[model samples]
Target: MAKEAKKIKKVVLAYSGGLDTSVMIHWLKANYEDCEVIAVTGNVGQEAELVGLEEKALNTGASKLYIEDLQEEFVEDFIFPTLKAGAKYEKDYLLGTSFARPVIGKRLVEIALAEGADAICHGCTGKGNDQVRFELAIKAFAPNMTIIAPWRTWEIKSREDAIAYAEKYEIPLKITRETNYSKDGNLWHLSHEGLDLESPTNEPKYDQILEMGVSPENAPDVATEITLSFEKGIPVALNGEKMASVALVKALNKIGGANGIGIIDIVENRLVGMKSRGVYETPGGTILYFAHQALETLCLDKETQHYKELIGIKFAELVYNGLWFTPLRAALSAFVDETQKTVTGEVKLKLYKGNLTKVSLSSPYSLYSEEFASFDEDDVYDQKDAEGFIQLFGLPITVQALMAQKGEA
Candidate 1:
């Protein structure tokens, strides 16, 4: 629907085979003059969503479909770095969908260039954060490439309108009117939005919507205990069995989900300056973040640990705002890597009925010296030294009190 001065010959779409992208394939071809639509799906741990995706894309009117296996890189490059940075959007969201956009957008640009496409398209809506995420990545990689966002330009106003359009074209859909919650899934987490979730007062239909795990009430009566080993802040093993990063996360997802560990319903402030409600299930990610912070207590010094917490807030903002490819993020990542150097350790945890309780933690780099911290007398730290230290620390307070007495006199 956007008016363009020149005709677009070909478009490479970041296809997810979801309702929006599925509708976009036909919409692009029908609207543009002889525009060849090429579809690119990034396999970023969407698991079962990738099943029969090629057949679906081609059937939906795409000339060719490319499914890029991006799971390993997604876990290693994107997920781990963010994990090390300790970034969490709005303090609890874990950024399940935020970081996935850049990697997908990068692939979209690559395929568009390779296929000699004039534009890159995505199914991101105007109201959501994904539109900025997708377009910003596209702009970073392919500044001049025409980006077509159908949700921003199209006549379809709501999911109901999109469904009607899809039904008219006979496009196969996996969802129905009752089950049409906007969802995004990956290795780290699954997110649900729209529909009944839009109302803040409506308690989530957890029995109906939960896919990753059971509700707290349905979790096993017994607690589940697990040991997580980390090397340089990346989780290397679960229960002492060393596993690949991808496999480790998947294993924890199963274990953590069974115990009903990680589920949060939050009304978050979107980057688009609108408030939206969402339910997130991040069982594995929750366990990892908790364990990593526990390990940093043993490894990181007081100053560095406190400062990194500040960095985490800014890091979360950058990622949430789709500024991953920018200089500030790269610089922050570098600082995070430095902080994670000695973050090698093991942590034991108990998961029970949506609660994570730390059992124990240990590290070779631990700065905790019992000799100096014990209640009894110890030679390592002199008790008399505290008298001078407190005086110097409270000098400003003493000076202010002296000035108050002088004015009274």
Candidate 2:
């Protein structure tokens, strides 16, 4: 820690213009002694959070402020690939925080190199997973640059202490100890952690916590039906209207949020090896995943689909563990892309009270054959053929049963 700090004259920080990051700008200058802070905020569809950010950064003593609109790139490059791979952490999590970290880190490293900064700093905490995600990405892109994680070295202990420091340094912040719930948001999803969520048994105060979207309990009773189109597993249109990748997500977020489509709560195992509770609102992502899976069921054959299901689990872990820039993740993504070649279709879904019910689906590559599957009459299928096929398919089970019978006798 001491060794890296000695030479860090300037740092490009992944700043959010939020409580922690705003505090970090002043804290870095104070602790590093005459060091310049270059603040970089990636606009990955954080919408309102970006308003007036430059003023905040400058007020907090940032030498410069860079706000890049990464909505399209983030959706196309990062979000789509992960969505195509069906990478959901645990059974419920959408890997929102998992994937957003690297995208943000990529820009941070880019700014660091452009500014000729000696190090990259971040506001991620010591205990949480973002530290690993951001730092590992920085190492992947700019290996030689020093990486500084302020949470690990800062003297301020808790949220309360940080608030005190913010007040003392005259850093503008809207958060206090009682109201602070650590949150991360992007185009994909919004996640809430800390505070009452730290306990698995405690029920969340949804009124206080539901910032991104409403819960199903509060949603309107009427069900909303919509159709979504996909091309090679990438969502392309909503309700027959073609949309840009970023626009599609934004549209679904509103429609899904209105119908109370996406809200998840889980006590998940973190990358750093502790169980943590998070409540996530992934309105757009849930719709995309649901629609894409329906398309896959229509287009993908049984063998390829089953194999990809197994791959999805591994994909989820790789994303969650911050291995996005690694060769293994790239290799897995290549396989996922291959499977998605024929996964083009439109899927109809009914969204109501947190439920996304599959109503109908169609695809150009659909393997479903109504004629062959019919019970009444079809030249394409013969009942006699099933005798041979079933016999062969069940051979192993028959043999095992015969062995058991002989032993019993």
Task: Give the TM-score of each candidate.
Answer: 0.98, 0.97
Task: Report the lDDT tens digits of candidate 1 across residue range 16-55.
Answer: 9989999999999889877889999999888899999999
Backbone clashes for every candidate come to 0, 0
lDDT string for model 2 (273-338, tens) is 989998899999999998898889888899999999889999999889889999999999999999
What's the TM for model 2?
A: 0.97
Native-vs-model 2 lDDT? 0.88
lDDT of each: 0.92, 0.88
Span of 10 residues, lowest total lDDT, candidate 1: 1-10
